[model samples]
Target: MTGEPEGPDFDVPVGLFEDIEDLKAKLARLTAQVEALTGGDGAEPGEASADEGEAAGGEAAADDAEEEEWQYPPFILLLDPPEYDDELRALIEWVEGVLVPGYLAEPSADARWCHLWWEHPVAIARLHAVWLAWQELTDPASCGYTGPSVWHRDHMDPALRELRGSTGPFAGCVKGEHQIDHRMPGLVPSAWTHAED
Candidate 1:
């Protein structure tokens, strides 16, 4: 009896193994180049050439600087006189184009909205907060697939509720109306205040 099996001969495609080896060589070269660029002496990237303690301290300082820079200022704080107009224009575009059309529903007594919302400082602040949160949350790089839902639940819904409530800045406003005379009530007189002279 013959030792060889009688099944059809199996063979790998020509040059397949060579191609795989070529890819591996290319990958190794790229990895080595990246390591060289990133300071591949088993040290973290951007580690200083100084002593160990000095490097550690430097890293800490860099981290602190990054944290400080990362702190986001509120909309009111972002109003540098030079950049005010441009910033406001961008905000208005987002509000009118994306926010109003996508999220805001028909304004009612329970949920008031002013057409000239920018005139109200409180409305501007609230809307800016919402916009910032939206920017952070809706970005796939910042937050994963569920970011939009999280923004809706944690940021947009609450801000809108407060901003559009009956006691909100738009209290004097309604659908199809913008109250030119709308004014936020002033605080009660202080104890030192006296009768007009």
Candidate 2:
């Protein structure tokens, strides 16, 4: 006759609530910063900005809703320094605070890594992709009960293998050393170079 649900109790991960709150605070601050930089009037995010008049308020609201909806930019690698700086800092914070300590194994010959991972463009792109997936897949409202597991199995694992694997972008660097001049192999020379020979 007891009607208390029968499923095993799900223990929320330690510090998860704190992490969500922190992310919310950071997002708010970043939103404000962006607004200031873009000459916005400091309106709350997603709040449509328009004159509140008896006759025109509704139409203005609808139009402003579409116009002012904030969207996170993708492809940090494609952004300029000013555009990507904040995003890069956020990614760095997450990597250092969570990803490295929680998920990464010790660096070794087989699991190569670089201290200056940001110096490697490909590594930055890959890590950014992983971070994006992490944000979406870890959100309970966005993804169902299997969110975290899906993030780990699909996003984190593949990214870690690609980024830290022996032949990855960090292949030329090591745990304590960063190759100052490391670069991806250049494109093959013009096919016509040999035509003259």
Total clashing residue pairs per candidate? 0, 0
Give the alpha carbon lDDT tens digit for every residue of 128-173 in model 2.
9989988888888668779999988998889889988877888767
Candidate 2 stretches with Cα past 4 Å from truth are 1-68, 183-197
Q: How many angstroms is residue 48 displaced in model 1 relative to the true structure, after the best TM-score fit?
A: 11
lDDT of each: 0.69, 0.72
Model 2, residue pairs in steric clash: none
Clashing pairs in 1: none
The total number of steric clashes, by the backbone 3 Å criterion, in model 2 comes to 0
Candidate 1 structure quality by residue, lDDT tens digits, 77-129? 46886666666777899999998999888889998888899988787888888
Model 1: lDDT of residue 22: 49
Off by over 4 Å in 1: 1-74, 180-183, 186-197
Candidates in order, TM-scores: namely 0.56, 0.59
